[model samples]
Every structure is written in C-alpha cells, then in structure tokens.
Target: MARARICKPCLWTALLGIGFLFIWYFKVLALGYYWLSTTVNAAQWEGSSLWLPGYQVAVEARPIEGLTRNTSGLTFNNETGTLFTVINRPPQIAELTTDGRLLRVIELEGARDPEGITYVQGDTYVISDEHSDSMYWVRIGPDTRHVSIAARSSLGIRIDSVHNSSFEGVSWDSEQNRLFVVKEKLPLRVLVIKGLDVFSESRGFNIDISEWKSSSAASLFMSDLSSLTLHEPTGHLLLLSDESALVVEYAPDGQPIGMLPLWRGFNGLQRKVPQPEGLAVGPDSALYVLSEPNLFYRFERIQKPAVAAN
Candidate 1:
C-alpha cells in the first residue's frame, strides 16, 4: 500500500539529478561558465587581435596520409616551417606541412610511450614519454629520418603519476626560456621546466620544475588537457582539451582570455573534432591541431578586411 504513494519531492529530485548529469556530460555548464567569463572580461581584448577564440577551422579532419594511428602532441618548427607530432604506440614522430600534409614520419627509437612532441630551437625538440613520465631532448635534422635517443639531457619526475596520464603535451616558451608540460588529467596540471639546458652537451644540469598556477590556472574548467602551445609574440598560452572540445587561451599573467570550441558548428568545424591531442601555433598565428589515429585540423583567424583610406 505504501508503494502506491509516489513522493513528488523524491521524483523531482531524481529528475533534477538526471538533468544535472546530462548537462555535465555534455559540458554545458563548463562551456557556459567559460562563455560568461570571456564575456565579462571582453575588455581585456581591447588592443589584441591575436586572440585564439577568433580562429575559424581552416582544415578539418584531414587524414594524415600514410599514417593510420597514434598521432599525438604537436609543435610548429620555425626553422623548418612545418609541424611535428608524436605517435605513442610503436613510438614515432611525424612531420607535417602547415596545411595537414605529411612531410615525413621520422622513426623514433629509445623513447617509450612518446605522447607529446615540441620543437625547442633549430633542430632540437623535446619528446615526452607518457609511461615513463620523462622528457627527452632529441634532434631532427633535415636529412634525418630517425631520432635515436642519445645520452642527451632528460628530465623525469615521478610523483605518484597515474598509468597513462602523466605527460600529455610540451611547449617551449622561447621568451620565458622555459618549457611547459601538461598532464592529461588526474587534476590536470601545467608545469614549467626551467634552467635545463636543452642544448647543453655537458652532464651537469640546473633544472627547475615548478607547477604553473595563478588565478585563472586555479580554475581551468577543462576535464582534460591534451596539448599546449605558447604564442611567443604575445606570451599567450593556449591549452587544448580533448574532452572539453576546446582550446583556451590565457594571458602571460595566467588570465583566461578566449576560447575556440572544437564542436561541429563552432569555429567553422563541419564535425566535432574526434580527439584533439596536439596543439601548435604557426608564425602566422594559425592554429594547428592533431587528433589521435591521424587526423589534422587547422584554425586560422578570420581576418578583418582593411578599410578604405579617408
């Protein structure tokens, strides 16, 4: 008889719980918060036209020819005028043109579970080994087709790192003379590696590892950080989140400024990017993104046309 009485409050509570789960699952709340934040902080963009959120998808879901899987982090090589990404499983490095064409796939040796790759300077690049929680400095020359891990410098800090979420992306801030490495999740982290001479041949090293946190960093709403790129010109740091389907830009002071959503309708994307793992910014401020299993996406700012002279 008691079963015949349906408590209205309990039913309403259950419905509310389900609604909340749906919103959370779809990232509606996170996106809303970010949207509100950006709107409220629009004044911060007064003079800067180099905003990340203003980018529109130039190339979407272009398959990297000859590669079928395991394409991760990305970095724009200023010297080569190309892009580089990592393949964790089977461990390899792939170089691509600015428009998503595969230039070459450099066979990587001695790196276990390479998930993130970033170009430091000249022929120097750093690759992050996810499983080992280590970063190795390697060189990739023009005629080079392979990168065998040498006795070069590396930094590994294992502090209760999870199985596969240790290191996800790496970016070199040339202006700051520091390297930024991001952990995938497990309370998503951004770290700054300084004083390590990436080009140093000697055995001695003065490395400093510190967590990068500020008012904005303390409130990063992304579920996971997949990759990161530093805009050396403006010193703006861009972070990519596969789960969030978003690319968020933060000022040098760590203030969140803008965002580019990887959803189907947002930023001229025909379809939501499946899995964005690598992020890079070219000299022209074009954004290059790599998704796992070898898909490439490029986003460029919608340039405003010049007005006629008065």
Candidate 2:
C-alpha cells in the first residue's frame, strides 16, 4: 500500500511534465520560433537591402460589393483583362473588373466546393473542388448563366485523407501547359501536372503529375496555402498564406525569393488582410488579392522615393 501511494504520485508528476512539454513544443516553442523566423525573412526580402525589392500594396483592401458568399481562389483572365474568383457555398464564379467592380456571377451547379479557378485557354478554365479533390474543365461567357460538369472532363487526385484539407489552390502555366495544385496543409505540397488536355493512342489524356521538390523548402516559410498565382512576366510564383498573412514569392526553380507581409503596418493599410483566399497577377504586373467575407486588395510595384544625395 505504501509503495502504491509513492508510484501514484510519481506517475501523476510524469504525466504533468509530459503535458507541459507538449504544450511548450506546439504552442510556445514551435509557433514562437517560426513566427520569429518568418518576420526576419520577410524583413530581408522587403527591406531595400535585398536585390529584388518586395512588392507593397498600392491601394487599401477594398470591400467587394455584390459578392455575398465566401470567396476562394482567384485567376486573372488575360483575354478579358479581368479576374475570376470562386464561391464555395454554391460553387459559382464571379467576374470582376480591375477596380473590383462585380461584372457578373455565373452559377455552376455541379462544381462541388470549388476552391480554385485558373484560365487554361480561350474561354476554357480549370476549376478545383476541394471536397471532391477533382478538377473540371468548363467555359463561360457574357451571357452564360449556368454551368454543369456533364460536358466537362474531371480528373480527381486524392492528396489528403482529410476532406477539408484537400486541393485548395491551383495555378495554370499557359505557356508550358502545366497546372500547379496546392494541398491546403499537412505537409503542404505543390503538385505540378502536365499534359492536362493531351491524349495518347493507348492512354486518354495522359496527364503526368510531379511535385515541385523545392516547395518543401519554401513551405517552411508559410503556415498554409490559401491561393497561388504565376506572374507570366517574371515566371515567378506568388503563394498566399492566410494563417501567416503573407504572400511568398517563389522563383521558377521553386526557391523562395521574396515575401510580402499582409499586415497593416507592412502594407499601406489601416487594417490587416484577414483570411486571404485568392491571388492573381494582371498582365500589367499588378497583383490582385481576395479575402474571405468579400474583400479585394491590389498591389503594384512603385518607385521607391530617391534618397537625398548624401
């Protein structure tokens, strides 16, 4: 009986220590250290010290009107000189002008939880459904009101067992005819797929999927991926992270080249960008961003004020 009492106290003490360690690792040490590193890296990328100066928000976060539902991915439509964003609630598409004027909303009945949209070619787009972990090819126009998946071709890739953390964002490389899809989190990966619309004699639409190996290194900079956009002019990638509130710039080789903090102090904003969901780069190299609960933001490269000659 005496020995049992001593062991009981010892066991309770051990359990308490283990619990403290768990909290320290995940809540304190891990997150604290990561935030510190992210801030330092961002400073280096944004400060004038770096060769490639980072971008800053030219305008403030604009409240998007007529978009009542939650917005997800965004893609710049080169042909129209506009942008397209997805609504996951009813799985619809919203067309907006450069200034964020809502042009129209097209209802997509069969697009389940559409989280990403990317323009593939003339009137053709690839939309990703997070719940289904699938991609659908469809076309829309000025008068088009409704769309379905019956006439579309879909390719499903299961990347995560968690339904919500599946495919979250996608970017189309029109020049190379490749598609890059981002797994939301849980070892966040970027899958590069080629031959999306190509076919072979033995295999139909023989799509080849590969991962950008360097994304593993880049993932260390962000918490989770909310959207992705490719800047055609620079052939660089802009990765949006909602949790970290950042837009990370990755080179063609997938190395993290720069990062723009989506915070109030960093950018010319009175408030921070909350829940950024979509990102797109216009043909003029202007950056467009969308946040949940209907918010739009624009960023551009502006000339730095010349320092007075010393």
Best of the candidates, lDDT: 1
**True-structure lDDT of candidate 1:** 0.82
For candidate 2, the 10 contiguous residues with the lowest summed lDDT are 301-310
Tens digit of lDDT per residue, candidate 2, span 1-310?
Answer: 4553468888899999998677445544544554555456764444331212345677677777899768999998877888898998877899998888899999888877999999877778889998788888878776777888665678889865476887888998877888989888876777899987722222257779998755444244566788887765456677788887877666576656566778787756678898999988776567788999688888866643122100
Let me know the TM-score candidate 1 reaches against the reference structure.
Answer: 0.87
Report every candidate's CA lDDT.
Answer: 0.82, 0.75
What residue pairs clash in candidate 2, if any at all? none
Model 1 — which ten-residue stretch has the worst lDDT?
301-310
lDDT of 1 at 213: 72
lDDT of 1 by residue, 13-98 (tens): 99999986885666666567768888687666734635656678888899989889888999888888888888977788988898
lDDT of 1 at 227: 92
State every prediction's TM-score relative to the real structure: 0.87, 0.81
Clashing residue pair totals per candidate (backbone < 3 A): 0, 0
TM-score of 2: 0.81
Choose the strongest candidate by TM-score.
Answer: 1
